[model samples]
Target: MAHEKRAYPLWTELPYAGKTHSPTIAGGVEPDAGKWKTYFIQHSRRHGFKKLDGRPIRLAIKDPDSIDWYAQLKVVQHTLENLSDQEKRIAEYWSAGPPTKQWIPIVDRLIDTYAIEAPRAARILSAVFGGMNDAFVVCWALKYKWLVPRPNQLDQHLATYICTPEHPSYPSGHATISGAAEVILSYFFPAERQKLHRLAEENAQSRLYAGVHYPVDNTEGLRLGRQIGRIVIEELKKDTVNGLPIERSSREFRNADIITRTYEQAIPFDYKSKCDSLLIRDDESTGNSSTKDWIDPKLFI
Candidate 1:
């Protein structure tokens, strides 16, 4: 895809387009593609070999080729063709920077609205973002393995709300990340289960609204992402402090008890200065989460 030199080009097409990642980049076609640079490999290694439950926590992404090709294209065409101006604005609002980092603010707002204590909120963010990253690893692997073309490739005249990412289109990265986040966050904040999941579904659909992904891309991505998230949840539940599960009860996270949290597409002019606290809370200094001691993962969810 040729770079469109316009004001704020980075927003339309981020530097190093988040989805440029391919399975081949991590050593082409290795059966052990699952082992390729997973964040948990280093962080969870010391904790001991872990699995989703009894088996390996890997996503079996559906082969896009198996589906009817024209049927999928019709979905893309319908979504793009009927996309209203308001829907485009809404979709653009949901388009997280790849590899899907926009979920940070949403998480932050949730924390603030719930007034969750520092330690608890840290644990929640860590698990959710970690799961998302895990999903991305699998998503990229399947993306290059399938090498499915984007909707625009089939029809060049298709107008997109944002620059279509340069990558194989089988699994939508946004959908994958959203799926993982939805599961992990819902686990910790089960009271917000309905809202959290609705957001996840919307996030997946946003790709279609942007005219970037076919229907199957969002569909399979969401499924794969949820599986990855469950694995992370299983691992998160293993942690104990004073012999109690780090995972808390849903009763404590009731919607009535917490303030409402909402998200929008707006970015503050001084976003750089304000993001430090809202996005990645400086929990390391305060020793907010035990997971941070080892992983110290950056929060993208």
Candidate 2:
């Protein structure tokens, strides 16, 4: 599929109003989307981990022309019209920059809070960042491959709270990075798993709150990122000194828990429920009864 320009002008007051977006153009970021697919993490070669390839990962989403696709669009429109004050704040907070800008501070905070030593802190940073790099490579590959339009692109009347990104929006970059951060950080700090996951979820949802992505973008992005995170963890487990695996530790503090508890508590939008219900309906229509048949095994791998 070919990437296309936005049908409507950018919501932001900028030169984007008259100009179209092209990654190959002067101001574009990462013009060559496929270049990083074969990049290896720090310990990948040392641990014999195969270079991660994003080309094979496919999202189980409806075609953009299908009824379900429009249904998903309607969800975005509904969200934009009914955005709560909290949701608006969430969008602005995460929109500060690319995912790394926020994640680095989080990692630093965790390292300081736990009083982690130099060696452990180094490992945490390397693993999390490495995993996020791989996740982006994969996410970008699929994004350009699908070339799905932003929610505003599909609906010209729709105006976003934040400026729409130049790249295609199938799987969200922020969600993908957040997912990778959630898994890698949780591995090092299991006590904070729930809190880390909540952060990741909110990061993903923030895209929708900003009216930039379809719900499926966040859902599939999280799944894709988590897969990369698991792969990174597997590679890390193989790193050994004199045939013994390197030390991995977890820590907890009452202060950390108290701080995390202050985050807002509310049910996230259930994007998957509608998709699941449709899958069940298909199962009933067809004679096929095995749930495994519907699942893409590569996603799990």
Best by lDDT: 2
TM-score of predicted structure 1: 0.69
Model 2, 24-107: lDDT tens per residue? 222334535434643343213233224344233333333333325567789999997887767866775676546666676678
- Candidate 2 lDDT score relative to the true structure: 0.62
Query: 43-122 in candidate 1: lDDT tens per residue?
Result: 23433224634344434466554666557768877876676656665565665344454677668877877788998888
Q: Which residue ranges in model 2 land beyond 4 Å of their true spot?
A: 2-28, 37-67, 249-301
Report how far residue 16 has shifted in candidate 2, in Å.
Answer: 9.4
lDDT of all predictions: 0.59, 0.62
